[model samples]
Target: MSSEKSKYIVSAEWVERQLGAPGFRVVDASWYLPAQNRNGAAEYSAGHVPGAVFFDQDVVTDRTSPLPHTVPSPEFFAAEVGKLGISESDTIVVYDGPGIFSAPRAWWLFRLMGAKNVYVMDGGLDGWKREGRPLQTDLPEPAPADFHANFNPYAVTSFEEMRGIVTTGSRQIADARSAGRFTAKEAEPRAGLRSGHMPGARNLPVGLLSTDGRFKDLASLKQAIEDAGIDLSRPVVTSCGSGVTAAIITLALHSLGHEDNTLYDGSWAEWGGRTDTPVVTGEA
Candidate 1:
């Protein structure tokens, strides 16, 4: 296996070579939209990379929160990760069913919980499966590990910080929702939520940053961000329907070496559902 500094994104070929390396943990962080009606854990059980553990986003998150997939407390995260046999020192490669969707969320989650060697598999299981990579139907029985937790607040954004950004426009807000959703032309998939975006936010639609679930190269990522009118030199906060796909933007920013980006934990779920928070719609 490659060192941490050289391997933030492992291709299918590389992952195949390091299938059972020591200190390596593969996690299937697959999550889906409610409308899709897909069960990530069920799919994971049916087939997954050998020795891969299922990281259930809903079950592992802040259960007390009304919002979806809120980042849990560091203690909570550590406890859950420990059950999955992951530790701070492990080289974790997280992947979802799709290429780069929910996997980045898992990557971000580990990073926030102080895992220095976390990574997102570029093509994910889909890529692995497409390349005819080996998979196992029977789950591996891993001994539970003790994961030490350290919280990094800089990787997360609070509602208060989001509100401040809305007023000051100091930090550039990048919305990962589709252009229609960003413009309020289409109804939200969730009920009782406003259709639009946070005020002063730019619509970057995370899908545009990747092709077939894998992220675009650095040059394309730069173009995409610039096309969205985001000033990369300034601070950036990424948001999506909830907070899942926002991590795609976070991943892209990190790939570009923009380390100042933060992911809005509440995202549009908390913002749009609140009657008091400001909302604006229409093409940018």
Candidate 2:
């Protein structure tokens, strides 16, 4: 693995330089867990990177599903991104307050919609604030653009497909939840959900992939995956509490040049809630 930084992530200073440049878009994809007690939208309203548009995780989701923040249809996603004045060709940079957390979901969404030139802002908005970069409270007057979304279903895995993987072990399953939650030693943040991992799943907590709100170098990221007993040569399915942090694993795997990977959108929120799903209560 190499220490290439340009493929998957960009620094705060680099984002500042591209602020007013043409065909470049900055998106604030901040989202918080319920326990964090913080409102991502409210924080974005207070202040964000200049010319940055807010991408609400809750709003940019499939409302038809009972699960929280499910991925929306390609048509709906295109309309919402178009309203944000983002064209498919533009360079999109996504960031959250905490680096490599919720922002990758937006990055993943852009890729799933067949939009390229997307990168996650390393160190996130917290690094921007620490560097004393310009922050604006006033919203930009967005001019709607033609964002034709071409969705690729291969980037995501359905529940039925995931169930098949669990039974057959055809692909590697990576759980991005904390060690305690993954091992069923601690309770889940969501109520009424079982605390354990899928059968034959590998535990790769999000912490190992990043540090101090920034992702590690490529070699380190690869080593972390290898230490978790995952083979990059095999296919992978990443899952988290509700499919948000799952992208962190997907991002790391993609950064490592492993393209045969898909995210489990239903994640544990759907898996643990059902009584029919077989969940193991210890390490894989």
Candidate 3:
């Protein structure tokens, strides 16, 4: 068994034990692209981790943004999460349907909001179900609590910051999009966006970071990053179609005990859509 550890991720057995434990809360951060045709709320309604609140990714974002799933204001996050009775003091464990995909976004959201004890449930809800863990369909009516969000501006990246990084070579860029999208061979799911990746960015496709729907162990994850030609010692900024899968990179890096990384919230949705920013079509 690999003894490697990630403070940002917890195993199903660990969460089972922590269930009903004081100061602990579980959140079903399930979400899917429109192409998937899966309703996150519907799945959560059918069955979910006991006491787990559903964190709707679509609604928990900046509604004003034209792109999808943009991070919402700290006040909005606090209020939204507070409705589920999650406070700053509570240890929040987040999970999604397919392991290691959407849950990382929720984990990153909590971290960006300055959450102290948020973790992504390793193997996610799918793995939990496969293991015969308990589930519940009834939603809990949580008494609202005050979630005082302390936003960490450094945890996220902006389009202007990405431009500076590309120009200065200050940070290594990683794209969580697939190889096709990264190579410009495949059309973007979102219309009007250009094909290709940000210049100097490495393709880390979020799916490659996992196995059997679960994230790989720390050693394998380190190898994956190294295989992408990314210098393990340098900092990384993760990007994706709309900043969703990018969190998978953030989760992987955090699992490796890496700290000098951030997620580009706008990602390619903003960068590729704009004609001003330089984009490269081809492999790194």
Worst 10 residues of 2 by lDDT: 1-10
TM-score per model over all chains: 0.96, 0.98, 0.96
Q: After superposition, how far is residue 1 of candidate 1 from its true place, in Å?
A: 24
CA lDDT, every prediction? 0.88, 0.92, 0.89
TM-score of 1: 0.96
Off by over 4 Å in 3: 1-3
Worst 10 residues of 1 by lDDT: 1-10
Better of 2 and 3 by TM-score: 2
Q: Residue-wise lDDT of candidate 2 within 8-103, one digit each (tens)? A: 899998899999999899999999998888888998999999999999999999999989888899999999999999988899999999888999
The model with the greatest TM-score is: 2
Q: Give the TM-score of candidate 3.
A: 0.96
Per-residue alpha-carbon lDDT of candidate 1 for residues 80-193, written as tens digits (9 for 90 to 100):
889999999999999998878899999989988889998888788888889899999998888899999889888888999889989999799999999999999999998999
**Cα error, candidate 3, residue 274 (Å):** 1.5
